[model samples]
Structure formats: structure tokens, C-alpha cells
Target: MLAATKRVAFGAAVMALAVGLAGCSGSGGSEADEGGTKGAPGAKKAPGPENAVRLIGDGSTAFTGAQPNITPPQRLKPGEKPPQFVVFSWDGAGEDSQKLFSHFRQVAKKYDAKMTYFLSAVYLLPEEKARLYDPPKHDIGTSDIGFGDTQGIKDTLRELRAAWHEGSEIGTHFNGHFCGKEGGVGTWSVEEWKSEINQAKSFVENWKTNADLPDEAPLPFDYAKEVVGGRTPCLEGQKNMMAAARTMGFRYDSSGIGNQIWPKKTDGLWDLPLQLVPVPGREFETLSMDYNFMYNQSGTTSGDPDEHEYWGNQMRDGLLQAFDRAYEGNRAPLIIGNHFESWNGGTYMRAVEDTIKTVCVQRDVQCVTFRQLADWLDAQDPATLEKLRGLKVGEAPRAGWPAFTATDTAPADRTEKH
Candidate 1:
């Protein structure tokens, strides 16, 4: 475990800036094998009676039916053990020169896994129209990470359309990558946060006009209804963000830090936070993220060439350890965050890919998006969830899975809507 002092210091440093599957096998079967009634990514239609697709503002997005490729969650039967859940989310997700956004979409398909992509609003807004963004405390056209180029915006739109069809959740990362105390998200009020959130949706809901790509196909889902939650930039302003979000119908927020334990609702939103995992051979732990690994390993994005491999392996091992603790012990969901960056020779990216390949194929594991996890959480009985939350990090029920979750009350007729 990380000492309190070091954890605070390290978290602050990492947050000061740093903007950025499975089916084939296993005892429980891959997510693809679990429920893949929908056709391939681009072929599946949204679920609806008429299955009509009405275009929203400027035809940037459409009111497609329910998202495809996602299976509605079921309540755990009496004395049943929970399946291990792992969420691999990307921050500032956009397809740029690196092509990582599209690359990972293919990777998820191959592994039979699904993920969450926290799309930064600026990614869909072309650089030429940067002035369109009205960040809370920053000047007009001011963005710490800047806006994407024309082609980058188009490529990102294509990926967003396909990713949703493939069952991945598209959450917001808000607009502008502001951090620290001065004019950062932390200082923004709830109203300001609401404004930021609205703008984020606006950029996506009207990307066709904003980016001048009238010929591009409309995004498959409505941004207003599709986006159920998000992580604040640098994980700041979550308190205010959640306050603003809940009233706007958000179901969860992933902008806090926690240990390996089942989540609980806070302020009416499921608080799915990044966890503190071991840093390989080190005594202290760091947040389960790529930038923290880079910060602790070399304190620079361009670290020693020889140490890149070691650093990558260290991060991979640390995440695996975190997964193992929850998979084999408490059955808590593992929340991991990353940026679409190639810092440290793209070592962290490689590490993430390796981790996905390793864990997504394991028996009884489900690599799903935050929204999916929230749906599962919602299906559980409140008392059952309270009991599950009683277990400490990495501490399994001494009575065993069946005996521990055993309930005498009649089960609730709960059903999840993907």
C-alpha cells in the first residue's frame, strides 16, 4: 500500500498536467460468446420497435434504438458469486496520427471484450473552429491539449460510430484539459461544470457543422442519451461535476480514487474510481494508470531507452496483480485508466494491450464498460450489495462465495436495459 503522504504528493503531481476482449475460450465463455446476437460493428442496428434512425442537430448524430452488442445484466442468484469485472477506459480518445483509437477497437473485437472510450469534446472539433469551445475558466479557444486536425476529427467520428455499434461505451472527458488550482476544473462551480458538460455534448452532437464534414455518416447513438457518465479532466472537480451530472441523469462518475473493492453509490452516482495498485517491486502503490507509472519510473515521457521495456513490464505486472487480487480474492471490479498517448516510446500502450489479452480471456472475467458495470450494480439487491461492500480489499468471504451471498428474502424482479 502507498503511504498517505506519498500517495497525495504523487497524485497531485500526476494530475497537474498529463492530458491524455476474449471470446474464444474460458470456463464462463468470452463476452462475445456470452451475448453476440448483434451483427458486426457497422451492420448492427439500434434496438427499437420501428428501428428508425432520426438525425439530431446538423445530422451529426441520430436517435438510433438501444445500443447493440451489449447484454443486459442479470441479478445474482442466491448464494451466487459475482463475476470479475474489469474496465479499460481511454481518456482523450481520438484517432490521430497514431491510429490507436481504431487499432484498439479491432483489438477489442479480437479478444471478445468491450471498453469505454472517454471522448474529449475537442477531439471532434477541428482546430480551425477552436473558438467554438467555451471552457469554464479558460479563455475562448483555450485548450490545454488543443483541438484535433480535420482528418483526425473525421477519423475519430468514424471510430465513435463503430465503437458504439460494437458495444463500447462512449463517455465524455469534457472539453479542455485544464488542471491544477489556477483556472483549473477544481475551481469551477457546479454551474460552470454544467456548462462544460453541455458544451462537450454540443461538440459531439454537432460535429458535422463544427468540423465542416457534411458528408460524414451520422453517429449511431444520441449523445444526450448515450453518454451516461464521465471522468473529469485530471480527475479534478469530481465533487462539483457529480453534483451537476446527477441532475442531468448521469448514472456514474469515474473521477475518484479507491482500493480494490466493490463500488457504492455516492451522491446518487456510482463512484467507479481508479485504484491504487502495486508498482511492481516497490513498497508503495500508485494509481492504476499509465502516467503515474511514467511519473514514478522516469519522471519524464522520454525516459531511458533501455528502461522502457522494464517500465512497461512493471506497469503490466502491477495491473495484473491488482486484477489477480480481485479475481481470486474479493471479486471487486478493477478500474484502469489511460490516455491515447505514446509516452515513453509507447511502452504503456503495449503494456495495456498485453494486460487486455491476458485478463479478458480468463474464466469468469468480464471486460466491460462503466455503463455495463453500473447496470449490473443496479440489478443487485441493496442488502446484497451492502454485504458485498463489507468485504475489505482483497478479502474474500470466509464462508465461501455461495454461503457468503446467501439471502433469505425473496429476490427482486430486477432487469437491466443496455
Candidate 2:
């Protein structure tokens, strides 16, 4: 699925509005987190009791106790500044000939960062077993992104396990990659979404059986509990998807578009959507995703070879521009999305890696996964968050961080309107 050509087109107007986990300590997820105020630093996992690895159904996943390396989120002190959170996420995550999934994992570790990998379950279901997926509106075994081969499944499984052990999040990109009005996810009923969600989880929970890898070690985390959120295919079907996701205990949803502002709960889940960032030299902004940038710059995956370098730098600089606005202004979390494909001669991958290296190392900046961001949000005072939300995108408080959040007001829960 990583190598498939994505033909979905996102317009700038729609693009501007879209919205779009622990591993154990020292499991070699990343370098030890350096202690910084409000920054989630890398830490060692407390040793689990003997025989803590209890395998789940078909031995595809296991219960491994609390995820390691995650620092318990603490409420912000009266005058504390919020950390500048930068989330790097991937959709339909898998490993193929390009090996982007594994490659990015190493990049995150080297930069002291953790990311969210939204796995498309079809990647684990071999082509011969494709019929196992009953997509909402498509024929059985149909997937626009295609299915995995035996070796692809094994390689993807290796990355998933290591990523979890290293403290990154593993979310669901659902199954079949269906979109559009004809039986696409946009038309799915809440129950149908539920079915798709269940099927996605089932594939992960039973890959050992589906892929005939019976001897493989179970995934280190219980996916049912671990997968708390995801970005939908093509960023479609969010309204009903959130409805279904909330009922399923999802803590967040990233299927919408927004400015670089603080997030709030919508429909009982954190509405953490992808954001609009400048396109560097362009007059207008676009969603902070590689595909959207590619859509606007070259309009196709294979654009002019000469322009590849320029296109990549534009994305990297765009992300940095967004990061700077947040880091120096309202301190809103900068949410970014990407895929494992080497779109535009792997320029997007390079852009992502460069952005990570540049921003994640900054003091008081936490380059973390969505799960960690949600945890931090949950830890903050509602009144403080309300005040933070009042500050518009790229707007900082006049009196500064200390006086701005000095006192908590008793405001009702601020739920976002979709």
C-alpha cells in the first residue's frame, strides 16, 4: 500500500478547512528525553513483572502493562507556559520496497521524537486473503491502495512492534481505503463505521492467523486500548467517523482542517485536526500534509525533477513557519500529516525529517505523538485551555504566558462545533 499512487485531489479551499503512545523506556525507541519544562522527555520503562506478556487472540497482540517511557502528564502551574507540541503523523502506514516506515522510525529516534503511525489494516492482510475485508460500500477484497504480499506483511509487522516498543502510537487508518459518494466511507452510517473499525482492529489482532505468521511474536500493545484515534482516508467521513469513534472510546480524531490553534473536544473526542500552514512562496496556505502540498505544487506525484528540491524545501519551510508562529505566538500544537510513499522523489520524506530535526530539539518543544498531546490537554485546567483557545491563531497574549494563565476561570466545557 505504501507504493500505491494516490489520485485523490484536495482543493485549497477545502484543504484550508480540513481537519485532518508509549513504548517502554530504553527499548531503544529514542535517546533518553532531556528534562525540560513541560516537554515530554524520553525515560526508561519500569520493568514489567515476569510473564507480563499475555497474548491476545491468535497471538497477534498482547497485554504488556502500562506503556513504558511515558511521563505522567501534569497539570500546568498557574503561570506555566504550554509546551510547543509538534505532531508528525502518517496515514496508511506500512513497509514496502521503499522502507519509509522503518526509515522514519529511525529518524524520530535520532531527533528525540515520537510519532503516530495510522496503520491501514489491509497492509497486514495478504492479497490471497483480501476477501476477509468487507468494506462498507465496495466489493469484497477491494482496496484502492491494494493489499500486502507475504514479505510486506512481515516487514510491516516488524516496524509496528518496534514502534510500539519505542513509545510511538499506532492508530487505525481503517480498512479498504474507501472514499467518495458511491459506498464510500462518507456515506457510511455510524454502525457501518463501527463495522469498519472492528474489522480494522480484527486484522491487527489476528494478523498471525490471517498472514499465516503463527510463530511471530504478538504486537507489544493491546490495539483496542492503544488505538485511540486516526485520520480517515482522504480526510473524508469525519462527521460520522467521529460519532462512531466517540462511542468506541476514541480520545481524539484528526480528520479535519484548521488553523494552528489549540484544540478542543468535539462530539466528546478531542478534535485534533490537521492545520493550515503557509506554502512558503505561495500566496495562500494549504493543509499541513504532504499530499496537499504536492497537489498544489506539482498537481501530481511525479512532478518535474528539477522542481523536486524546491518543492521539498517549500514544505519544510512551510512547516517551520507554522512551528515558529506557534512557538513564539499562541503556542498551539502544530499538527502535520504524511504518508509512507516517496511522493515527489521522496521530497516529502526529506521535508518531514528536516522539520523534525530543526523544531524538535528546541527548548520547551515536545515533538510527540497525538496520544501524548491529548494526555497533555487532558491534564490542563479547562479554564486555562479556554483562555488559550481565545487567543486566535498566531496571536499571543499581551501580558505574556504568566499573567495570561495566572488564574483559572470557571467556564463551561468549550466544545467545538464541527
Clashes of each: 5, 12
Q: Assess the local accuracy of residue 173 in candidate 2 as a C-alpha lDDT between 0 and 100.
A: 90
Residue 390 lDDT (model 2): 81
Task: Tell me how far the alpha carbon of residue 213 in candidate 1 is from the true structure, in angstroms, after superposition.
Answer: 1.3
TM-score of 2: 0.88
- lDDT (Cα, tens digit) per residue for candidate 2, span 317-358: 999999988888889999998887677798988999999999
lDDT of 1 by residue, 352-411 (tens): 999999999999999999999999999998899887777777777765777777786322
Q: Give the alpha-carbon lDDT of every model.
A: 0.80, 0.80
Could you tell me which 10 consecutive residues in candidate 1 have the lowest summed lDDT? Answer: 21-30
